[model samples]
Target: MNDPSPAAWLRPMLAVHRRALAAGCAAVLARTAAGLSLPYLVKVGIDEGVVPGDPDALSWAVLGCAAVIAVQAAAARIETLALARVAQRMLHAVRSRLFAHLQRLSLDFHERERVGGVVARITGDVASMQPLVAEALVNLVTSLVTMAGVAVVLVVLDWRLALAVLAVAPFLAVLVAWFRRRSATAWRRVREASAAASAEARESVAAVAVLQAFRREEVTLGRLAGRYGEERVANRRPIDLASMFFPAVEFGGAAATAIALAVGGHRVIDGALEIGTLAAFLIYLRLLFDPVFQLSELFDSVQSGTAGAARVAGVLAQRPSVQDPPAPVPLPAAGAELRMSGVRFAYPRADGEPGPEALRGVDLVVPAGHTLALVGATGAGKSTIAKLLTRCYDPDAGQITLGGVDLRATSEDELRRAVAYVPQEPFLFAGTVLDNLLLGKPGHDRARAEAALAAIGAEPAFRRLDGGLDTPVGERGEQLAMGERQLLAFARLWIDAPGVLVLDEATGHLDEESEERVQEALRRLRRGRTVVVIAHRLTTVTEADQVAVIDGGRVAQADPPAELLAAGGPFAVLHDRWLRSAAAG
Candidate 1:
């Protein structure tokens, strides 16, 4: 598919900064007029000053040219400054909007997109437009105006010579059209190839530890080399096109200059053209090509900017699938019940088709201040349940609500304040432990953060850190052990202790000592709140108010722990196996 024009989005941005754009444009015209006048002054010095032996007039002409140069420099500086400020402001808005929109986009968008591809839209793609905005824009205006000014001067100097020089205009126009279409296609492929390569690099780096542990470094390098080679192949097409285009334009300009020089030389000899005018024609012939030549550079900017803008625009065009109602419904007070009724959902495929249903008419609930542990085999939809509860991915054909408020109706801010979901692996932003802790509740101080950690019985573990509560967690809390990271997450939970909390297999794979610590923390933390716990290990759900056995995307049985054990069904078999496995661990 042909990419949408960057002008679709860029025009409005340019319009918003119309005043600055006007200023820059004014400077462009002024600079062009001043610079173009110099050749006229040189012509006059020869015709009216030197030919008549008027030294005073020649000195005046020289001084006039110098004055015009100084003015041109000033106007050029103003144009550069004005456009620079405008570009910075425009890109700042684009980057911020891109980032904010990415955040607002539904989870499925992210699931289908590579991390590096998404990041490049904001970083690399956005940065590519800088030249188009700052330098190329200025060059575009300067070249066009200089050529137009030169065209008028040449016509006045001698229409006969101007007509001869103008013969190449039609050919140049056709060449420009060809280059624009071909280069745009070539550069677009380059952009896509670059983004793919970036994604490969980032994925490799993120999984480097896994690659090493599995002794797959050489294979990983081979894959990376393959992607780099793909990028090289993509890039070569544009380089080849440029190689053909630059020389073609240069030859056309040289031919036009040669013809203009020959024609003007004859006119001057016949006294049909003045010596000064012939000299001006020679200067202007070169000047005319300056802008013609600039078209090639301008095409690069236009193509690159167009490619980047299209990607950025595509992201911005996405409307969030999950959004608050026109008038948001406020969540009820703390300890509201959480409910899912006939929740049916299927994950979307990257190919634009929907996958088979993961949850089929599933219905479940947790009363206020109650703990419901969900026990299920892998792929039985336990994690899917947690995600739906938190509104990460809304059910395709059902409703999930908290305190009688539909999740879709509740504003994101209020819902976030009311519900908390802790996954098997929680992502921790790069910061001190205290900073992560402070993310718990607004108005929470350092002492309060420490207290929240203590409330979950994980304070002592963190207090032993080199910086204690102030220690850096590194990226995603990698500086800490698994249990330590779990404890920090629980501590953040302890701060708000929202009305609804969802925990997904938190202690499934921790070391014995770390599991014990996490278990202890979980025990202290599941107090006076509606909690939905997803666990494969039966041992973790012993203290849950009720245990619900999930099988084949439906709740097969649910009862108090002791009651379910006595029933001797699937839960009983799972409990027996879990007991042996827990002991083995």
Candidate 2:
């Protein structure tokens, strides 16, 4: 889809609430009509009632004026309420769609974007459109209608006075055009500055712990201050322009009113016009210029909204880099068997240059229900292999298969159901223990959840908590210990029970006791499943049926642990170093 302009983006939302929008428009017109009638009513009271000393005419005119005001007030209230409803509903739809699209986008897209910026788009940027969508558009319409009505009434009162009023129109248009050009640019800068400030603040707060650990609080504070300063500087230009706009509009209205009064006063003196008619022309002048002033004021909000809509449209237009095949093949029931043939892959670089290859010519196989452990130094592509097997990224120049079915040809749903990858750092949402557990297998009640936790020997950890299964995990599971979070991850996997498992340094961050507990759980979880472990510690490799040593994006060696240890290859050297370090400790 092409990126929608502000009006185009709002059209669908407006269509959804078209009935309310129509009613609001009707209300605005009714209110404007009532307001326009007041000047003529004043003319009637002065000429036919007060000047003639007719008590009944005077009383009737006063009553008529009062009735018009009452109607105007009622209509104004209806317009306000109706427009507010439409604005809120449109905002709700916009927010929901943006959030859903962000989720559907590929992980590569997210990795390249700032979380703070994305959050700002969903929150502050979306909110900036409220004034424009809910009130400014309606106000613009109402002001134009009021202006037109007053113009017609002025002409009917006396063409000479109407011509005097019309003299200001050209100057008013020029002033408005100038203000719009300046203020639009100013307002766009303001929105950009505001978004930058918001992104900086969000990032700082999210990484407060890191800042504190590195003793860089002052540096972060300085950066935030700089961002806020830019936002303040950008805001000043629009505010100065708006201040000039309103007073300039007022001056034009005064000039036009003065012209009408001077001309009409001479005509009344010459007996060419009635006193009431001249009085009505002065009142109509004010009414005519009122809408012009209001529209000028609304211009700022409209500009901000336009910029926000553009940013939102850019996000919605992004198609995911990784997508499901149009016609996907189904994996067989025995698809747990995993293989990567001549696999080669590289990450994408920001400047469109080729990134260093993370994996190269990697041939490997793991039969169903067996475990293969990959041992390598950091950045040697151990995790990359796990990522490939789980289809996080397709190999650039090779094929991965499960049960002889190419990974790309298989449906995403089937592939995900068949293989599960647990990363080094386990993430938990803000919820209760039971809520996090239920995410793995929805609709399973407490009894089933407890069984999954118990099977991994993690039930006691939860039982020790204040509320057991109902205990709040806090944000990102901060309330729980790191080991506890890891155990919950294992328990989740136990419930999920995928046919294949990819453990990417799952126990790398745990302490000795925690590692022992997790290793016990891993043994139970691995039964009848094809398991691939990215080994960080030498201990994990010892039990694997076959150990593959990765070096410089290639498979350096693959053999049983005993044979590899005796061969004195890369794996032997790594194990010997680990053993020496262990003995020294």
Candidate 3:
């Protein structure tokens, strides 16, 4: 997808800031014009009031200038409020759109990226643009207006002096250009270093327990320190470069003022100008150089913000590898007759060599409402088949059909609604048990939730909790034991009542008691639903209506467990191993 152009992204923000920008411009023009009148006020006091020794005229002019200062101060307050409103509204819109775009991205995109980095881009990077548009841009615009007004007035007084001041302007411009380039490079480094540091910190904290258990604290701390050092170094370069700008610009400003003073003084001494006119010229020179210097610094923020914008836009620009068809296939109302025919697949690999092939020319079928068991050792492509069934990824070469419809043509929403996945380790979102269950089917009433729990033999266990359905399952169901979590997952799937169930059997983690309960729940949940179980347990394998023993990405044996065991094939050997292992234990 073509990302939103800079202009396109800025248009909405422009609209949000339009009223404030207008109000701010009016306030700026009024305040700046009032400020410029100060030099004239001094001129009047010096030439007309003080030269004639008229104390009354001097007092009146002083009072008038004070009144103007008060009005300007008031206008400044109003302008600050107006600009703040504009920036806040614009950031809100930008952040909302960025967050929405993130939601629309594919799951694969998230898997490949880090949560911390993505969050930083959306929340942190978008925030960086606020001051660039609000204070910096606004200040620059107002300063330019003030500078232009002063220049025009200065020229009216003495064209020769104005030309000299203009000569100094180019030197300031060149200085600004140099600073902007240096700051842009430094800011990019700062953002990269910060993101790397944040990613490291997040990873370390997430795995802190494991790190401690493994006695890897020193190693992890060293890595964290290294990242922090990089960030500190990156941060220091900008400050160091910025340090040069202030002193250099200050010196330039002082030099410009001294030059203007000396030249204007000579003219005054020659009787070509009044003392008041010399005073006004010096004031204008100060006004001109101050903004020029400040604006140079503001330019740095602009360049940095643009770089951040490009990074954010780049993420929003990516097209998901998997997308819904132009004309989406409607979901089947009833359970699907899921099939995989001569499927071959490989994960994308970075090396030039061919990728790791997970599956090869394997065929299988599960009729509507029938259960199929896929049994294999680790890395034997059992889990890959489940992912394919749900269209998590498309096979490299073959077809996956659901209810006689090709999955590639089906809408993701339709497929997800039709299929329910029970991963080996189930993830539970924060909320009450009831809330997590209802996520499967929004508006799932309590009675239905209770009924689903009952059907899966979870009611007794669930009732044991102090608050029944309202019991909170701490983060990721940490409050629940692995077996209890498994039961809840089954209950959730049962509540969803999907057309198909894909269960990755919980084998090693559960205790004997939890395993029995989950196995019983699995039996009940599988009834009347088309189910595919990636079995690692002999009990589940024995109960499956059909078993496919996968080896080297192909089905080595496919039969009823009893029939296959009698045949002394791959299934028989696995069955014997399970029995022997069980007997020994």
Error of 2 at 148 (Å): 2.3
lDDT of each structure?
Answer: 0.86, 0.86, 0.82
Candidate 3: tens digits of C-alpha lDDT, residues 393-508: 78889998888898899888888888888899999998999998888688769999899899888899989999899999999999988888888888888877788988888655
Error of 3 at 115 (Å): 2.6
As a whole number from 0 to 100, the lDDT of residue 56 in candidate 1 is 90
Instruction: Give candidate 2 misplaced runs (Cα > 4 Å).
Output: 1-4, 332-335, 351-354
Candidate 1: where are CA atoms >4 Å away?
A: 1-3, 440-443
lDDT of 1 by residue, 362-387 (tens): 88878898999999788888888888
Cα lDDT tens digits, model 2, 88-187, are 9999999999999999886667877788888888997799889879878688878889888888888788877788669889988999999888987787
Error of 3 at 2 (Å): 13
Considering TM-score, which of the candidate structures 2 and 3 is the better prediction for this target? 2
Instruction: Decide which is better by TM-score, 1 or 3.
Output: 1
Name the candidate that leads on TM-score.
1
Clashing residue pairs, backbone N/CA/C < 3 A, model 2: none
How high is the lDDT of residue 41 in model 3?
90
Cα displacement (angstroms), candidate 3, residue 443, comes to 3.1
